[model samples]
Target: IKPPSTESVAVLQQVPIKPLTKPLTYPSLVSVVEFISFGRRKQLYAKCPTIRKLEERLPYHLERVEIETIGPGYIILKFDNFSVGPIGAYRNEISMWCPGKRVTRSTNLSLYEATEKFALYNLSRPGTTIKTLETKYTPKCILNCIPLTIENYVVDGNDRDKWIIRTTRPVKTLQTDFIIRHDTIKYAKEVTVTRPSHLPIRIHTDILSEWNCESITIERELTHVEVVDYCRKVSKRTDRPIRSVFKSGLGGYSTELFQMLSRELNAKKMELEGFFGNLIQCATIYINESTELSVLMMEPEIWIEVSTTPPSTVLQPIKPLTKPLTYPSLVSVVEFISFGRRKQLYAKCPTIRKLEERLPYHLERVEIRTRGSDYIILKFDNFSIGNFGSNNESNGKIAMWCSGKRVERSTGQSLHEATEKFALYNLSRPVTTIKALKTNRVLANETLIFLDTPKCILNCIPLTIENLIVTDFIIHTDILSEWNCGCITIEEELSYMEVVDYCRRVSKRDRPNRSVLKSGLSGYSTVLFKILSRELNARKIRMTVFGGNVLEFANIPINETTELDVLMIKPGVLKIKVCARRTAIDRAF
Candidate 1:
C-alpha cells in the first residue's frame, strides 16, 4: 500500500510540464538592418544586430565569416566570397523590426562601405550618368619595376599623399611650390558628402590634365617695376622751375620788399636793448616804414638813430624860506620882521612896526654886530624908560645869541601860560628863541633897547627873564628901540593868549564844524565814534581838550518822540525800559 501511495504522490507533483511555451522563440525583428561590403567580392558585413542574426543563420557554404562589434554598440557579421566580383563593389540591404517589439523579423540590410564606388548622376534625372570612372590604381608590376624611382618621386612629389602611383612621376614638385601651385589652380574641384547624421566628408581633385592643360606653371608675374629712365622722366616732369625776379623800384616787387622789410625789422628787433621806451621807438619806426612802403614800392630810407642819452641832471628849485624873522629885546621886549624887502632895514635897526602905518615908534637906537655864523652882539644907548626906571640910570651892557626854538621857560605864570598856549599852538606853529647876555632895565611903556654882548642898556633895566615878555612899546622910528614894554604880568598873559588864540583860530579856520544833518547823523554818531575809539587807541587821535563832554557838543537831537530800547550804563549792563512812544528809532534828528 505504501509503494502505490508514493507513486500517486509523484504523479500529482509532476503536473505534465506545460507544453514547452511556444517553442521558446525570440520576438519578431522591430528595427531596420544595415550592411557594409567590400566591392567586387562577396565580402558583405552586417552592420546591425537584425542583419547580423540573419546572416548568422545562413548556410556555411556562402563565404568566410567574421564578427565585428562597431563603436556605436552594433554587431557586424562579415562574409567574404572573393571569387564573386571586383575588389570593392556591393549592394546594401536594410531591415528593421516593428515598434515595441524585440529584433526577430528578418530582412535585407541597406549599408554602405566607404571604399565602394558610387554613381554620380546628373542633376536633371536619376538615370543620367555624368561620368563613370574606376578608382585610381597602380599595377603591382609597374610599382615593383621602379621601386626606388617611385619612392624618390613620392618623396619629392607635389601631392602630399605620397601614393604608390606618385612614385612613377619623372619630375617632382617641391612642397612649397606645390602649395603655391595648388593655391593658383582655380580649376580645382572640391565636393562634400553628407551622411544621415549630417556630418560631411570633403574631397578635393586636381583636374588640370582633363581640362586641357599639360602642366601648370605656378610662377608669379612682375606687375610693378621702376626703370631708371622712366623714373627720371617722371621726376623731371614733376619738377618745377623756381624763378626769382629782382626788380629795382618796380610795382610787382611789393611782396619781395615786404619780406625784406620783415627780415630787417626782425634783425633790428633782435638787436634791441629790451627797454620799453626803446621798443616803442622801434615800433614807431616800423610803423612809419610800413606806412611808407604801403604808399610806394621804393621809399627813401629814413634812418633815425634813436640812441638814448643818460637822464639830464635835474636841479630841484630851491624853496624860499617862509618863516618870519624874530629878534629878542634887551628890556623884556619882543620884535618881529618880515625877511623880504625889509632885510636891509633890519641890518640898521631891528624893531617891530605898527600894523596900520608900518612905521616904528618909541625909538631907541641899537647896533648889532655878528660875532660868528649864528651869534650876535647888541649895543643900547639913551633908551627911553618908563615904569621900571629911567634909561640913563640903568646899565647899558646887553648881548644876545641865537639857539634852538624855545620849548620851556621858568617864570611861574608865564611858563604855565606859554606851555598851555603853545601846547595847542605847537600843533600847528613852532617858535624860535634868542638868549640875552647882559642886564638891562626896561620900563613898562618905554621903548626897549637891545645891546651888543660887550655893552648896551634899555632904561637902565635888566632884560634877563625866564619867560618871553611882551611890551606895550611901539616902533615910532626905524631904529632898534621901537619895542617897549607893557606890564610884565600882562606880557606873560599875552603869550598864553597868543598860543591859545592861535590854536582856536587854526581849529576854526582849518576844519569848520558842519551841521550834524549835513554830515549824516548815522556817520558821526555810530561810524565816526567807532572810528574815533579805534584811532584813539592807535594813537592816531589824541585827547587835546579834556574838560567838556564831546557827546553834548555833538548836538544830536533828543525828544520825547524818540524811543530808547535800553540805557546802557556800560557796554554790557543795561537798564531796560519800555516807552510808549519814545523809542530812539522814532527820532528824526
Candidate 2:
C-alpha cells in the first residue's frame, strides 16, 4: 500500500487533556488575517446560557481571555479583578470582543493604574474559562460567511463581477431580532440577532467614519496555491498550525473550526467580526481542502481585496455579476483521516471479540500466518501452552520448551489435546480426585477437567478446537435417572448433600410453603420433588426413614390431597417414594 494519502490518514492520537494553566497570550495584529478574512464581513454567535449571561456582566479591558475548560459542548472563561492603569494615560478604556459578548470594556484614569490593574488575578490561579461555544449560532455564522467572500476568490473557471456593497448601520443597538440574508450561498444564508443584544459600535462603519481615523483601502489577489501557502504562514502568526489541520482532514471552516478559532482569538485578546466565521469557512473549503482556490488563483483578476470602502461609491467601472462561485464538493478531508487503521481492522474482523475471549490470558500480541491454501496459524503471546517445571523459567513456557517436565508434550499436536494431557498429568497423586470434588467435572477421557483459576472461573485449555469428532460415549447435559456401565454418559453430577442444600437455599430465598424449582436445578439435582404435608403449624419438616432428609423434602412443594409413599423391602434397604396428587402429578409404582 502506498501508505494511503495524507488526507486519508487520521490523527494517530489526540493530545491528552491537560489544563492550560498559563495566562492567555495575544497574537500580533498581522496574525488577525488567519482568524478572519479581509474579503468578507464576519460574525459569530454564542448561545451558551453562561456565555450569554457573562456577556451581560463581563467588562472588557483590552485583555486576552483564557479558557478553563474545553470539552464537548461546555467551555468556561477565567478572568481576574480588572485594572486599566498600565494601558496608558491617553487610553482611558479598552475593548475586547467575544461571542455573545461582542464588546467588553475596561476603564482606568491613568496609565499607571491601568497597567497595575492590568495583571489579572485569576490568570495564574484557580479559575474558569469558556474555551468553546455551546450554541447553534456559531455554526450558522461559519456557514453563511462563505458566500460573502466567494466573489473575492475564483472557483474553478468561474469569475465574479460587480462592485461589493458596504452597509453602515446605527451603533446604538436595541434588544430586537436582527436578521440578515444573502441570496447566493447555500449555507449560513441568514443570521438572527441574539437576545440582550450588544451591537459593536466600532463595526458600525458610519459611526466610525465620523472619528479622526484615516480610511485606507488595501487590495491584492493571490493564486490558490499562494493562498494555501499564505494560510501556512498565517497559522504560525495565529498559533493554530493551520497546515496540520488541513492535512489531518479537519480543514473545513465548519462551526467546530470557528469555535477553535474563537478560542484562540479569545486567548490572544484579538478582535473578531461576524463574517470571520464565513471567512474561515471559505478558506477551509476553498484554499485548504480543495485545489479550486489554487486553480482560481491561476486565472487573472480572480483574487481581489478592497479592505476600506472607496470615497466614491460609483467610481469603479464595475463589471456585471457573473456566475457565483460554487463549491461543488463539500466533503471534508477530515473524514478521510478519521478512518484509520483501527477502523480498517474493525471492518475486517467481525469476530475479534470471540478471538479475544479464547485466550487463556491477556493477549499481548497475535501473529497470523497463512499456511496452505486454507489453513492459518495464529501464534499468540502472553500465555503458556504447557505447565512449567522447576528447571524452566517462569515466563509461561510452552510444553515443548519445558525440558524433562512430567507433562511434556509435542507443540505440533492439537492445542486442545496437549492442554488436556498436561492438566490430567498434573492431577495425578496428591491432587484431589474428581469424585471428591464438588464443583469440577472431567471431560474427554479425564484428559481435561474444569479448574478454577484466579482471574476467571471458566479457563480454556491452551488450545482451541472447533467441531471435534466424537468416537465414543454420548454426553448429555440434561437430567438422567439411570446409569449404564457399558456406555459412559455425562450430566451435571448430583450428590446427596447437593440436593439437600439446594432445596434449603431455595426455601429460604423464596416462599417456603410452595417453592418452584427451575428446569436447570431439576437437571442438576437429577430429581424433581413434589412434597405435600398437612401440618400448618410445623416449622420443621417431618422425616421418615425412607426419605433422604426432612429439610430437603420439606421445601419441595406439594399440593392438597397429595400423598408421599416410601417403599422399604427390607431393613435399611430403601426404594424410591412415589408421590400422587389429584390435580398435579400421577402416582408411580
Candidate 3:
C-alpha cells in the first residue's frame, strides 16, 4: 500500500575525531593583558592566530586545538603567531585515573572542608583586619587542590568586580626519571647536569660541572671532626715535609752550632728567645780565635795529639843472659879420640893388611905364577934361586928357571901368546905351565924372582892348568924329567901309587878298635876292627893273633884308627873263650 507513496531514509552526519592540542605558546602582549584584566581566568594562549581564533569561539572554557594532521592523540597548535612548544605539553594529557598514578591533582576532601571552615570564620570575625589575618588559609587551600590552585593572584584597580589569577600544574615532575640506555660507548668530552635529579632540566644553569669527576661520597651523618681528620691525612699524603741532617765542618762550625740552630728553629714561641741566645753565643765562639784551626784539623791523621805530658825515664845497665854448659865428659873424650890418634891406629890396622899376610903361600904362588903371559916352566936349582928363559937346551947352572916355546924381547911377547892362540883354535887344549920371570934388575934380589910378575898380566890365566909351579931355578933335573915323561906312565905308576897310599892312611884313621873290653866298646867297634884288618892285609901288612888275643903286626901293636873310615863286620854268633900265651886274656864273643 505504501508503494504508491515511496519516501527516502535520512543519514546522520559523523563528526571527525580531532587530536587534542595543548596551548604551549604565549599570546600577544595586548591580548594577554586584556585576558588577565577580564574574568577569563582559565584561558589558554595558542601560538597561531587561526588556532587561537578558532579556540576562542569554542563554547567550553577548556578546549583543545589541532593545527596539523600528525595522527590521533597528537597535535601541533599555533597561537599568537609564535611557535608551539611541543605536543602533549598540557596537564590534561597525563591520565589521573591510571592504575599506578605517582602524583594526584585532587586535594583531600576532609582537609579541604576543614580549611574552608577556618578561612570563612577568620574573615567574618571582628577585629580581624589584614594585618592580623594570616596567609595560612591560602597555603592550606593550595595544598589541598594543587592542580586548581592559583599560582599568581591580583586585585583589579579599575574594575572592582574582577579578580585576575594565573595557575600552572606541572604535567610531570620535570621528567626527572627519563633514562637513555646505551651500549659500547666511550665519552670523549665532559658531560654536565644542571640538576642531577631532573632529566631534561636546564643543564649549565643548574648543574654546571663535569660528569664522572672523581669525588668521595661521604654519608650525610659524618661529623665535622671526622672530615677534618680525613682531610689532614690526605694533605699529608699529597704534601710531605722536608727532612735535613746538619753536620759540623763549614768554617769554624762545630756540632754545638748545629744543635743550637735546630733548637732555636724547633722551639715554641715562648722558648724561642732562650734558644736563640744560646745559638748566638755558639756562633760567636765558633767564629773567634783558633777555633777555625781546630775544625780544619779535625780529620784523622798519622800524627796523634797528646792531652797529657810524658813521664820521665831512668837508664839502667844491661846484662846478657847466659846458659850453663851441657857437654858430657864421655862424649867429648870419645869424639876427640875418634878424630885423633885412634883414627890413625884404625887406618894402619885395617883387616885388608891382615888378610893379605894370612893368605896361604900356595895361593900367592899361584897368583904370581899366573900374573904373566908366558908359557914358561919354573924350576928351583940346588941353591933355591929362581930363573927362567925360553930354551930347550940343558944348562948345568943350578938356579930357578922358566922356559917357553918362543920369546920376544922387543914386544914382550912370549910362548904364552902362541899357546893362547893355539887353545883358541882348539878349545879342548889344556894349559901346561905358567911362570913369572924376573924382569927388574934393581929389585931382583929382594922382591923380584922368576915368580915375580906384573899384577896387570895375572888376570888372563886359563883355568885348565893341572900343575903350576913358581921357582927361582935356572935348571932343574926333576922338572926336565917330568916334562919328558908321558901322561900314561905318570897316571899308571906314580899317581896310582900316591892315590893308594892316601886311601890306606884314610882307612886306618877311620877304623875302630875291638881289643877293648866289651862293656867299653860300642857296636862300631867290631866293624872298625874288621876294616882295619882288611886294609892292613890289602897293604900286605901281616898280622898274627897270639894266645893272649893280642894283634901283632910284625911283632908290633897297631892301635890308633883314622876318622871317616868304614869298617865291615862279619856276621856270626860268638861264644866266650879264653886263650893264653904268656897270660890268659878275654876275647870278644
Candidate 4:
C-alpha cells in the first residue's frame, strides 16, 4: 500500500508477498507445553530474556524427559518422537533427528555453556510437573537449579548423592529405586518401593520399613520363615494392621493372609463391607473398633501392602509409557507436538511427511466442518485439530489444538489455509478408509454453514461409510455422482439442477437406501421427480413443490415409478424423502 497524491497519482511502492511475522513476545508464549523436543526446547529456553523468575510464568509439564550423556562430550534431550542432541561434541553444533529429517548445523550456543544455561532454565521452573524425569547423572546444575518447590519428583537408576527432594506440596506417591540417604519417602503421602536393593542400602531396616507415609508397598520374594519373622517385627512395630502378600504360598484361596493375621495378632475374622483382597476367599482381620488389614493375591505377583486405610486409596505414580520413555522411532512415536509446530513439520519436513503418507490411517468416522467462515475443525476418531484466526492481520495470533494442550501461535496462514494445509498433509498422505463421513456447517452443538469447506474432504470420502451427510456444504458435481453411500442427505448442493442430474445418475447403479433434498425441486419438481422416477424405478410419487399436496403428509406414489414423502415441517420449509422398500403407509405409526 502506498500514499496517493492528487497532483501525481502515487504508484504503489511494494506489495508484500507474505503476512508479517509475529514479534517475539514473552508474555504471549506462556503456554503449558506437553511435548518439547531436544532442539526446539533449547531454542525456546534460550529465548528467555533473563535467567531469573523462570517459574513465575512458564507452567509446563514435561511429561516424559530423558537427559542422556552417552558418549564423551555428547549430551541428548529425548522427548516425543525426536532427539535434540549429541550436541556438546562440537562447541557450535546441534543435531536433531525424526522419522523423515536429520539436520546438523553450526550455531552460537548449542554445544557448550549455552546448552548448560538452557538446562538451568528448565530446572528453575517451580511448582511445574515433570511426570517422569529420567537422568543418567544428577548434575550440579539440576540439583541447584530448583528456585521454588516442585509438586512431585521421581528418582531412577543409581545416584552418587542422595539429594533430598524439597517439595512444598504433598508428594502423592513416591517410587524410589534404592534412595538411601535422602528422606524422600517421608515427604510422600504414599510410597511403593521394591524393598531396597541387595547390599548396604538393604541393611537400613528403619529406612526400608519407614511407615511415615499413610500407605506403603514393599514387594519382594518371601519365604515361610521370613513371613513369620516379619510378622513378629510388625507386632512389635505397630498393631494398626500390616498386610503382606507373596505369590500363592497357600496354593489357593485369599484366606491365607486373613488366617495368619487372626493367629498372630489374635485378630478376629469379620465380614467387613468393601474390604480388600477377594472377599469371597478373603476374610477381614478386625482387630480394633476401626482398624483392619486386607490382602489380595493376583498370580505370580505378591499382594503385600501395609496401610492404615485400604490400599486402593493410595495414588499410584503414573509411569510414562515404556515405549515413549526410550528414544522412539518415527512410526512408534505419538506425534507429541504442538498445533503450530505440527503444521510446520508436516509442510517443511520431507522425511516425516513421506512416512506419514506411506502409512494407512485408521479412521472410524470423519467430520470436517466450518464455524461461520472464520473457524474450522477436522475431527477423526478420537483425535481432532481446530484452526482459528484472521490471516490478513499483520501480526495476528493463530490458535490451534492437535492432541495435547491447545497452543496459540502467530502464523502467516489464515484459518482456512491452515485447516486445509493440515488436512491435506495429514489426511492425503494416508490411505484413508472412513467408516462414515460428514461435512457440516455446524459442529460441537452449534449449527453453522460450510461456506468455506475445503475440497480435500469430499474428494476422498471413502465408500465404506454408511452415510454421507452433507449439510450446507458447497458440493461439486463430480463428487455427487461418485457417491454410492447407503444414505445421501444433502442441502446446499440440492439447489442446482446439475445435482439432480447427478442424483439421477448415481441412482441407476446403486439407489441410496434413502435420499433427502432440502431445495431445488420447487419449479422443476415435475421434471425432476419424473427424472428420479425414471432413474430409480422404485415407485412413482408426485412431489408438488413444498405444499400443494392434498394430505399434509402424503406417501404419494405418482405414475408408479418413485416412492416419495412430502413433509411440511413449517410455513417456509419443505422436505422430500425418497425411501426404497417402505412407503409412508408402511412407515406410519
Candidate 5:
C-alpha cells in the first residue's frame, strides 16, 4: 500500500529536463568542429551523410597537410604544426611522425579508410583551406577526392602519374620532389624540382625549355650528350626567342663537342685539365655570329650555356643625331647595361633573365665578403649592393639593394637557403669579365645546394685572366700549373717538390699553348740548387745559398739562351710568372 501511494505521488508532478545547450549555430558548429576530436569527427561522418557535409562545409584551416597514398594511404592532418596522423585501424594507432604534446587519438579505421573518411569529412566542402598541400605518391582516386583550396601544392614522387596541383589561384610555389609534370608547371608562378641525389627529375627538355615563370629551378645535372641535346632544343626555341639555356653537367668533358664547336664556329679550342678539381674553361661554340653555345668546365662539373644573339644588336640607338634613342634600337645597349641593372633584370622574371643573357656584361669586381659569421655580402663595383645577413627589420629575409633602392627580397628563407637563388642567378649573368672575385672561405648553404659560392665563382671565371694577383689566399700546385694570365703574382708558399712538380706537369701538358714554369720561391733556398742539379743533371749551378728563380729555364740547362735559366729560391713565399713559352732562360754563362 505504501509503495502504491509513492508511485501515485510521482504522477502528480511531471518534471521536464531541457538540453544543456541549444542547437549549435553555424559559427557554433564551426567552433565545435575546431575543438572536437578528429576521431569523433570521423565517427560523426560514419553515421550520416548530412553530418559529413556539415563537417566539410564548416571551415577547417590547416597550415599544411600531407596525404601519402603510397604507404597504406596515410593522411597526416595539421602536418605543419598540430600533427595528428598515422591514424590506426584498431583505435590504438598511437604511432605519429611528430612526437610532441599535441596528439590526436587513433581510431578503429585502417589508414586507407581513415584517409578517405578524413578527406570526406574535412576536405569535401568549400570552406577548407590548406595553405600548403603535400601529396606523396598519391593515387588519382584520392587526388580527385581531395577537393580543397590549396595555396601551395607540393608533389613528391607521384609514381602513378598523379602529378596534379589543383588550387584556387595559380599555385604560389609548386615544389616537386623529383617527378615534375609538364602540364602542372604552367599552373604555378614558380616551380622548383628537387630530385634525389641519385636521380634526376626526368622531364621533357622542350617543355621546360619554353617555360615562362616567375622562377623555374630544376636541380638536375644532365650528361654531356643530354646537354648538347638540350642546347639543340634551346637553339630551335624560336617561338619564344630563348636567349640562352644554362644546364649543369655530370662533370664529363666532351672533347668532341669542344672540337666541333671550335672548328665549325671558328672558336678557340680549350684543353681541359683536372689539375685543380676539373679542367676549367669558358669556351664558346658559335652556331653563327648570332647564336653561340658556351661550354664552361669548372672543377666537379661542366656547364652548358647558350647565348643566342637576338635579331638585332644591343648597342645601337635608333634615329638620333649621333644615334637615335628609340626604344626599339636599344636592344644592343643591353650589352653596356650596368651590372646592377643587369642583376635586377635577372631577378625580375624568367623572360627578363633570358633577355639579360643574350648580351655579355663586364663586372669590374664581384666580391663575396663575409662580415662576421652571420652575414655574407655580395659587393659589386666597390658598392654595398646586397647582403644575405639577418637584421631586426629584415625579419629573417634577404634584402637586396640596387643603386640605393631596394629592388627585391628573399622572404621567409634562411641566409643559406637564399644564397642558392643568388648563386644560380649569378652563374647565368652574362658576365664576360670579372676583374676580381674575392672570397675567404668556401660558401655553402646549410642544405648544401649543389652550386656553392666557390663553385659559382669558378664557373663564372673566363678562360683567360688579364693581370692575376692572388694575395692572402692559399694557392696550390694545380693553380701554379694551370693559371693562364698576363702577369701572375701569387703570395703563396710552395715547397721545392711543388716547384719541381709544376715543371713536370707543364712538360706533361700536351696542349700547344704551354706556359713556362718560371718561379722564385723562398722554400727552396740552397736546397733547390742541390735538388735541381741532381734532378736535371745541371752542368754548373752557382753556389748561391739563396737561389733566385730556381730552374727558370726548367730543370734542364738549355744552352739555347745566353743567360742561365736561374732558380731563384727565397725563404717563405713563391712568385711565379707564367707566359707563353718564349725565349726562356738558357744557361749559356
Candidate 6:
C-alpha cells in the first residue's frame, strides 16, 4: 500500500491594527506586507497552496495580492490596491492567506496597512473599465470626468465624498505651458513571478540513483529542544531509547546529531591541517545569536571565496593646467589673459618692460632689503655655476649701483640668473619686508599701499609695478594719529543726490573756490576722501589740511592755460566721484 500523502495545513490569523484617525479614502489603495516565520519542522515548505479569502463584500475586491517565500522559514504577503471601480460606488473587503505546515508556528510580525493615493490624471487602461454608476449616486467635481476603471478610481466609494471636497478646496493656480508627469496605476490581475526555492538541499549522486539529504548539521552543539526532537524522531524510526551524553562539564549534547556531521567535521579538521589548507571554499553558514558564544569557542573556519583576478584599471587622459607653470622661485605677478588660450603681457612702463624681458631666465638666488620705511631693494646675485660670470675667471664685481650704494654684486654668474633673481624676489617679498619700511616720503612714492583699514594692510607693491598696485596717492603727516578712529564700519547714509549735485557745481564753476558744507557730514569720509584724493593725485595736485574743515588745494587750473590753487571741504563721498571728474569731454553729473 502507498504511504499516506502529506497534508498542507491552513493557519488563520487576525492581524491587529489601530483604528485610523480618519477612515481611509480613495483613489486610495490598501497594501498589506506580512512576514511569517516557520518553526523547526522537518518538512519541505512550498508556496502557499491555497489563497484563503479572509473578508469579502459581494465580488473579489482584492487585486494584485502577492506572496513571497523567504529563506526556508519566512513568507511575505503584499495585498492589492482597492481599485475595482469608482472609489465610492462599490464596496469590497480586505482578504488574504498563505500556506504553512501543521507543525509550523506562524506569526503576523511586521504586518503593516498603508493607504496609497493615486494620481487623478491617470485614466483607466484599455480593456479594463469601471462599473456603471447608479442614477441615484453621482460623483462631483473632477471625479465626474474620470473614466470608470480600476486605474482611474482612487478613493473608496464610502469615503470619496470627503476626498472630493478636499480636492476641490480652493487653492491658488497659475496658467503655464507646463504639465507634471505621474506614475499610472493599471487595473490588472495580480502578477505572480516564479521564484527558486530558498530551502537548502544536498544531493548525493553516485553510481546509483541520486537521493537528497534534508538536514545540514554544522560543527556546533545542539540545544535542548533540538536534542529532544532528534531523540523522538530516532526513537520512532529505530524503536530505541537513548539518553544524551554531555561532552563537557556543562550539561549538553555529548555528540553530533548525525554520524555524517562527525565525518564532515573531521574531514574539515584534516583539510585545515593538510597541504591544501590554503585552498578556499565558499559557503554561507546560518546560526542563532545565542549559539554565537559556543561557535566562537569551537573556532570554526569558513572560507569566503574572492575573485582571483584583479579588477580592470581605467586610464584617464591628463588635462593641461589653465595657468602658466612657475618654479618655486617665480611669483604669480600677473596672468596674461586673452579670448581663448593666447597669452600676452602688456608692458606699459619701463620697470615692467625690464622684468618681462628676463621672463625666459632662471634664478640662482635672491634677497630683499628694506630701505628706510618705504623702499624695498632687490639684491640679485648670479655667481653660481652655469651662469653669466661663472666661466670668466673675473672676481664677481658690483654690476649696478643706486644712490652711490653697492646695490647688485654678481659673483661670477650669468646675467640670466641675476635678472630672474631680481624679478622673482621683487614679486614674492613677505609682508614683513613692507612693514619694516618706515612711512616716509620716499616710501610713499616707491610703494602703493592698499589700506582697507588702519589694521588691515591689503598689499604693498612698487608704484611702478602696474600689475598689483592701486592707483591712489598719499599725503604724509607725522601727527593726526586718530584720523581713522571712530570710523564708520557700515555704509554712511550721506545723500547720494547731494554728492551728485556737488559734483555738478564743481564742474560748472570757472574757478571753484574753497567751499564747505557742515550740516550733511556722514561717516565713510576715509573712503570718500580716497576717491577725491585719487583724482588729485592723477593730476599731480596737492591738498593740505590744517585744522578745522580748512583744505588747501594747490595747482588747480580754471581753464586750459591759467592755473590757480583753491581749497574745498567735504569731497564727494564715494569712489565713483573719481570717475565723475569735473573736467571731462561729457558732463559727469
Best by TM-score: 5
Top-lDDT candidate index: 5
TM-score of each: 0.11, 0.16, 0.12, 0.35, 0.40, 0.15
Each model's lDDT = 0.24, 0.25, 0.24, 0.49, 0.52, 0.25
lDDT by residue for model 1 over 114-154, one digit each (tens)? 11111111011211111111112222222232222211111
lDDT for model 5, please.
Answer: 0.52
Q: What lDDT does candidate 5 reach at residue 176?
A: 76
Model 3: worst 10 consecutive residues (lDDT sum):
293-302
lDDT of 3 at 116: 39
Clashes of each: 59, 35, 32, 12, 24, 20
The segments of candidate 5 whose C-alpha lies over 4 angstroms from its true place after superposition are: 1-60, 73-78, 83-109, 139-141, 146-151, 177-180, 198-207, 210-214, 238-247, 254-500, 503-589
Per-residue CA lDDT of model 6 for 1-589, tens digit only, reads 8754444222223445567897444223212211112111101123322222211111222233222332332233333321212212212222222343122222232211111111122222222222211111112322333333332122222212222212111112111111111111111111111112452222111200110111112222234344333323322232111111111011232222222222222111111222211211121111221110011111122111111111232234689878755643233343221101111232234444544443332222233333333223333222211222232333543244322332334554444444434444343433312211112122233233433211112233322221111112232221111122211111233443344334334433443222212123354444434443454431333333222233333233335533322222233222221112343212211
Once fitted onto the true fold, the runs of candidate 4 whose alpha carbons sit more than 4 angstroms away are 1-59, 69-75, 79-117, 147-154, 159-168, 179-181, 189-205, 211-219, 224-264, 267-289, 295-589
| Candidate 1 segments whose C-alpha is farther than 4 A from its true place | 1-345, 348-512, 515-555, 558-589
lDDT tens per residue, model 2, 1-589: 4676655555543446688798434344223323332111112113334333323232222222222222332223323222222122235554333333334345643332332233232121122222211211111112222122111111111112111111122111111122122122112211112333243211222221122111111122222333334333433332221222111112221222333332232211112222211111222222221221111111112221112222442244679857643332212221122212222333476744343222222222222222222222222222133333322333322343211222343355444334444443322223121211122222433343332221111332233321121222233222112221211212223333443433333322312221122111223211233221222211222333222422233323334533222221221222222123321222111
